[model samples]
Target chain A: MKPHWLVRPGSIRLLWIVFLCILALTVLAGLLVHPHAAFGIDGSFGFYTWFGFASCIALIIVAKLLALLLKRKDTYYDGD
Target chain B: MTAISLIPPGLPLVLGALLLPLCTARLRALLVLGLPLLVLALVWQLPAGAVLSIDFLGHELAPLSDSKLARLFATVFAIMAFAGGLFGLNHMRVAELSAAMISAGSAIGIAFAGDLVTLLVFWEALALASTLLVWSTRTPQSRDAGLRYLVLHLFGGVLLLAGIIGQVAATGSVAFTAMALDSPAQWLILAGFLINAGAPPLSAWLPDAYPEASPGGMVALSAFTTKAAVFVLLTGFPGADILIAFGLYMVFYGIVYALLENDMRRILAYSIINQVGFMIVGIGIGTEMALNGAAAHAFTHIIYKALLLMSAGSVLYMTGKRKCTDLGGLFQSMPLTAICGIIGALAISSFPLTSGFISKSMISQSAADQHLTFVWFMLVAASAGVFLHAGIKFPWFVFFQKDSGLRPPDPPLNMRLGMILFAFLCIALGAWPAPLYNLLPYPVDYAPYTYAHVISMLQLLLFSGLAFFIMLPYLKRTLTITLDWDWFYRRLLPRAACPLVRALDAWQRRCSIDTLRHISHFLGALFLYHGPQGVLARTWATGSMVLWVVILLGIYLLAYYF
Candidate 1:
């Protein structure tokens, strides 16, 4: 069989590092280059970087609250 | 070529659907493949600005007309039918296939219809046919959902009808053209179209009912109804400011609900609302570029959304499981399915070099150029939310999370072929979008791929992925479902109805027993006293009359003598 190099323990750690590096590089690169600003705010360095992160967390918090009000048992309608 | 007058482009598919049950299985398959192709050819050959009118019920009905916009919608719709047909070749119920084809045909019908009368005809037919598709699954859940689907669509159909009647009364024409939303009738028309576009308060119907379809049926269901609404809204009520609010609500509602959702298909269903929300916002912006964005997004959305549904359906078909709670780690066995599903996810998130990247950016660009700062910011936030919820959540939970120890192979050959075809189209369009751009109603001037655009898009999406991993624990799958507007109908309405029905029953009982008894007693007494055999009714009355006459005669004599 071909070596399961992707699943090896060291390889997994290496993969995680690579992923983090890529994320950091994208953020760093975003600071270097200006996006043709859509709004005045979007042109700021790392606007997408921070906004995307914060909005996702904000969305999750809101969804969590909504879950309290709206969430029901999986079989809520069917009554099984 | 001969003038194709009487044969409306959609009729062949509708008629073919009616004939499907009569055909042997092989013949049925061939017809499904053939009908959409024929419609596509006819759609292309028909000249722009050609209108065919038929006299029906003393009103001229333009059942077939052509425009770049109509042709674009019709082309994508026909292509959708073909893909859905190919996917469903080996494993679909006869009834499902027939209903799906009929639904597809009617969508195409609406696309080509030049008059409100013809459009309404096709519109109502679409609701009925699609409801049949829902029920074709024949499951108890599907049956219940199908009934609700039918009711909601019929309600929308009535609104459209009332609006059409009012418009015809007010304007004295049936032409389906753009109108300012100044009158009540026009607002009603917008309301009707909005309801079908999965606007809030009625938006729950889409996620509730669509996931209940059979795997193949869901793929078809994802394509037609909402997109058709977008088409009509684009034509009828472009740049209506209220749509911006409605569209943003849908965009966020989809993300929040999808975030809370566990059923894989339901997640995708909610994302449909989310994606269509973008198109609606584009229409609301109402610039030439934005309208082009709306139309182009609709075209690309059909392909990618169907592809996403196809992947989810394949998982359901292979494993007989739908909830993320019951799914994971199938990438080991189903690499092709996983890859295609991931591609669909990336496209939906508008990652660079995807069809969504090409189509969706124009809407935001238009918003920015117009200096609508708040709209642009919200749209940007919503795009990030999309990547977080759909782009990462979908693939992460289904394929790569902790192994659920179930290893199902990829779907059958035809299903794979269908998914592959759409997957290819997604990338092909993303890499080169000119074909789709040319099909837009307006002229092409916007370039999707630029240094700033690609970099920002990647920054948004990749960071959203980072956020997902950080919040991994919060996004855990659960055995729960999120309630929405449908709860009013499913839970509250029924609960409210029970007390009402009991009160009415008690009131009827009291009226029947006590009130009826009193009326009967009064009538009986009157009958007895006034009978012919009674004393006052006979001799006594005659004696009294004679005595009075005698007294009157005596008085008259006395007066004369005096």
Candidate 2:
């Protein structure tokens, strides 16, 4: 059997590079864009930004926790 | 508030659903198909702003009303009901169809409602109707999913009712009117509307429950609940700021989850959230253009989403499989369904020549004019994302993936015909959006097919396509389930209940044992005391009887003296 791709040396290096590039680009774009244009003026605040980010994180965590308990076998609904 | 009721003359359509199950199967099918057309005719003839009010529990209910907005939504709803009934007639259980018709009628009732009370009543009827659709699948998973779906919607309905009561108390007005979200009551009402829009935290419920429903049931389910919420939001809380943030989250949330999903139907369900996200954002912006965009998007989205679901349902019906892993190369045999599905995909992605392109662009244009740069950029990114996951991923995996060796023929002619009609509308609306725009609550000036906009969108989507293909290895299907908020009740609550149940069982066992011991001790004491010739037992029955009679006689003597 072929080895898992992620564990391969070249694949790992490529993954990291891609991750870093995406992160750098996102930050650079945010800095370059006018803050008002990037975020709406009416409701944009440091609080909301943090709140939005935190809410997303919380949702992911909650979903993961729920999956542990509620997930059934793939055939849970299937007829034989 | 004017007392002119907007209730339609076709109120009996609701009652007719109850009579459907009693008819023979063939007649029942005809009734299901024909009733909506009849109602549509009646709705067409009704005078605008016509009122049909009645008293119930001391509150007046205006279950029907006619306004431009109400008429537009109601007309489409009636059309959807007819199409849905036609599509469902072949495969849906008779009882399920009856339930769906009642649900559809209630949604129409909601669209025509002139008062909060009436809207709420119809709102809850929608929930019940939708839940029955989920339950009709007759699987344990569907049963559980249906129960969870009911709970969320009921919670939303309760929130709405509370908000309405608060509004009534504050303003002494039950008329449904657009208001700023200032007071707790108004805010509650907004929350209620947001929940139905599949807003964040609670948003996962839409994706969770919908894909589990019966094939045709899902098509019916997709058109009603969220759109009703959109109707309420557009009417009641147009300028709310919180909605923008919620909408943005939903837009990306849909793309992300859909990207990860393996099931064709679930991917479409997630995409529904994404598409509705655009409308929700429009509602939040509350400009004439934005509101018009929201309204128009609702109309087009309903058609395309239903069409997409129908196409997916056709596949599921023919092959009895839903996962992309199990489906591939179906286009060879199911060419008609595949073509219809691709048209829906293009429309959803807002390709220049599709319904989505015409309707969704107006809101983005509204944002651009407002100088809200971030909102504009995000919307653009979401548009690209829409193409990435749904536009390409859906048709690609289902129709073009390495052949899975299944060549199920196209679904029945009726299903194909329904899809073709919807597909034609999708293209026609894109080509000439005037008719749809004319129907909007506001005038439309935006053109969707500018050279710059079209080219940029194509570039963005094309690059995203490249990315999808490049990273196809990461997009493998897995057997593991992706959890959503329903996990709280489906997993967490049940798991939490298990330990509680065990503890209660142990406590009950100990209590029973203790009670048994105590009773045995009491009996032993009595038997020991009552043993042959022992103490009180040795005293004769005659002596006891004489003592009792003496006591009675003494009481009688005292009474006589008094």
Candidate 3:
């Protein structure tokens, strides 16, 4: 018996390639559309792309830091 | 008046719940499925005004009314009841089905309540019913969690009651309408509504209690309370500026905490606050479009979030595992569940041609329309964060992470049917949003599928997806929980009480000791004056008594003569 193709490492690599291409196309699409901006600097090219990426990165960083202070065993409240 | 015309919109469902516990399994199933559909039909058929009103407490009380907005919320609530009933039809506990019906009915009642008193009555009913739903799980954690959930909701209810009293006193009106925020009454009302909406500082109650429910119960618990709060806020305090800040805090709080969470259900719970945050912000924005967006998002969010939870619940039902660390690669055996979960994930992420895209974009568009530059950007970023935490993270970790070797099949037919129903709705409402748009309180003026909008939203979301995978190492789940504001009552308050209790014990002991000494001193004085060896207690007592009487008589005679 063989494993499913989608979960295979080779197929996973190919899927990654396809996904990256789609990402590139979306950025290209961003370049193509002239969004009617209502705010300063949001009208710039690939603004949502960069801002979305940057915001998520910042969110993960802050969360990781907060975890250092706040994280506890899943049983934290169980004993109480 | 007909039976329904005399009673409120959701009374039948609540009444039907009473029959559930008494009925046979066949009758119970019938009541579960039939009651909500009956309510749904009745909701749409009602005329748009108060059909039931009476004089109560010297004011007109409209317990049942109909309007486009009310119909919108009631329609979704009824649909949710039907779907939840279908999913939980075989739930081990009959009590849960009963509580679900009551809460679902009260939510519809809230949608139609035209006066503060009527709303308050149904609101408290919702709190108790929801608490029952939590307790129905019959686990120790659920017992304690239900207590916390009940306490917070009761506090919210008290605030709401006090505010209603003050508002009625000050204005002598009970109409449930938009209110100014100038008075303390309005602030109290806003606080109560905010607490239920899962706004920050008090928002910890949501994730802490929600994930403690049964798989079936969680699906039912997810829809009513918070959305009803959004409904009230949408009706009661639109255009309140503070909600914008509250909404934004919930938005990010959900993301960061969910990103740190390991339990799959808890992730969805945190994201509930996040999803509701978007609606709260729209309500805060308070334009016609934004109000519509908030309402539409509530409608769409209920379905999709239910869909997500249904699938998650299905997995839990089959495998008895909920943590991402313990779940993975079940897509191998449960492809239907995986596909449905992914659809829900996409809908929640507002992927183009999904329900979220149509409904949530309107909220962001409204912010842009108002030229709220900072808000607009934050909403855009939060939209992306929605993708990170709920959209990709949930599906990736649960379905595609390293295989946990669980081979549970998709849940039974009823659960699948429930999930499919909502999944179809998520796409149907998005692919053709006209039906949903027509139900909004305001006229639809925005197009969701414009080329630029789709492209930019895709750019934002795809990049967010990229960011997620890039940061996947940090997002990995562990057997740890992140503390939130509930930590105050859950850990700190209990720990802080120990010392306070000891100090009070010491104070009471010292006081008792001092009182004992004082009693001994008083006893010694009594002994000195009147004990056996004392002069007054000896044989001279009679003689002294006679002498004193003689002296008293002589004094009286002398005074009289004078």
Candidate 4:
């Protein structure tokens, strides 16, 4: 079987490292500057970072559930 | 010059659109590009006041009025026209070009409208022109979609006109001005405006129809109608509290729907609602900064959204496909298109150093400034959701997912140029928003690039991206479409039609034929019993004659006895 560069083991590890670095830096960036919190807790370090992550996960889960209920064949209306 | 001598600023484009079809192809192309520039110049030169009025059927009509808000909307609209004209230069037919121009002109007409009557005229004109643009795609889907689009918009126009008539009748005036939700008429006006702004539960018209246009046609389609509605809302009902609720619903609604969409353009269509949702929220907040944000965001949004759609349009043009399920890894071949699409995606997500960043933050700032904590949090959440749905999902699925093994190159030169121009504007506006800020309806008092603000925005977006990566398996593309409000119209309504019609038909026949049958039965009985029957007519007459003489004598005797 042929191997793709992106899926190579070393490449996969590097990608993970890069992702973690970004996630960590984003969390750390909050320490450098304080947000004028709109809410009481939003002023905390990494507050938005965590909120953004949690909300996205929650939204995707809800969307997946919606997809379960509402999805039909792309040809649903086209009468295929 | 006196008002009598002045011309309405949008007339040249409107008239030129009529003349466009008569010319040769090249000449039509030249006129298409030249007409918008002319309109822009005319819009710029007009002073900020009601400059032209004429007597019309015993009422004064101001066809041209200029204010900071109106001019702001007019400027971006004209720029959009020019960019759209350029993009469609080689691809579109003469009819499409003319329709686009007329729509563009009417949008500007909406901006300059000084009175409700003139505004209604132009509002309906926009509907007519845009519907033509949709139909010019000349596909079956385009035809059906265009019809639906027309029906919905015309219904909205009726609401608007009804409201205008009621308001004018009650006030004994025709002027357009800021209004509150004090009357049913004003609420109707808001509904009319909200429909165009893609506010739900009527927003399905946008995603349902817009994706069916020709690639270049969609470019023009992306700009005018919704933004013009936003323009009117900004003019008419800036501080309506109910809009805040509607706007929040629309924001999340767009994200959820887009997440479930398989078609690339449909995803963007949902995002248009999302973007307009931000503007609507800003208008709802109705602070100075919020109004400015709404106006500024509208300007930047036209550019980036057009850019995004242009990229999607280019993909559809180069390859005869629009569904994300059928596209992937074209970025290897279509580098320019991919990069521009990414820029648009970033801009739309309000990433720092993009137009969306500079413009959209003001709305959230206002929410925070007013200490509407929940609204502020939701706006921030929506911003992150924007990144998840559009910023990464769009480009990632279309350009970088599992390779579909289809390697289509970039679109034609004019399209690339249009995308490049808007992409440049997206970055330029984000980097230096002074020019756009200067053009806003309010004073330029806010800055978008404070350190903490940029950091927080980045944190929200990057973490959202991280979440997207985490959820990659669940987000896989499939050949499925999620049901929306259109289900009522597209599925349920048509299915219900047959029984409804049969019931109505039965009632009609019962009323007419049943009554007729009963009348006929009565007439037949009357004829058989009394009319010209031989036995009764012949013998009875002779017997009665003889009896009558004897009866007369008897009656005389009886009368004497009595």
Worst window of 10 by summed lDDT in candidate 4 chain A: A1-10
lDDT of 4 by residue, B27-122 (tens): 887888888888888777676575577787677888888799888888888889999999988888888898888889999999999888899999
Q: Write the per-residue lDDT of candidate 3 for residues B1-562, one digit (tens) a residue.
A: 3665545769999999978889999989999999998998788667557468889989998888778999999999999999999999976489999999999999999999999999999999999999999999889999999999999999999999999999999999999999989899989888888888888788888888888898878888899999999999999989888888888888889999999999999999999999999999999999999999999999999999999999899999999899999999889999999999999999999999899999999999999999888888889999999999999999998888898889888899999999999999999998999999999999999899999999988999999999999999888899999999999988899899989989988888867868788787888898787788766576776788899999999999999888
Off by over 4 Å in 2: A1-80, B1-10, B502-562
Docking class of 2: incorrect
Compute the lDDT of residue B329 as modeled in candidate 1. 81
The 10-residue segment of model 2 chain B with minimum total lDDT is B1-10
Per-residue CA lDDT of model 2 for B280-394, tens digit only, reads 9998888999999999999999989988998999999999999998988788778899899999999998888899989998888788877778888778778767876788889
User: Which segments of model 3 are wrong by more than 4 Å?
Assistant: B1-6, B499-562
Question: Which is the leading candidate under TM-score?
Answer: 3
Please report the candidate that would top lDDT against the real structure: 3
> Which regions in candidate 1 have their CA more than 4 angstroms from the true location?
A1-11, A31-34, B504-562
Go through the candidates in order and give each one's DockQ: 0.64, 0.10, 0.87, 0.66
Task: List pairs with backbone clashes in candidate 4.
Answer: none
Write down the TM-score for model 2: 0.81
Error of 3 at A53 (Å): 1.3
Instruction: In angstroms, give how far residue B121 of model 3 lies from its true place.
Output: 0.6
lDDT of each: 0.89, 0.79, 0.91, 0.88
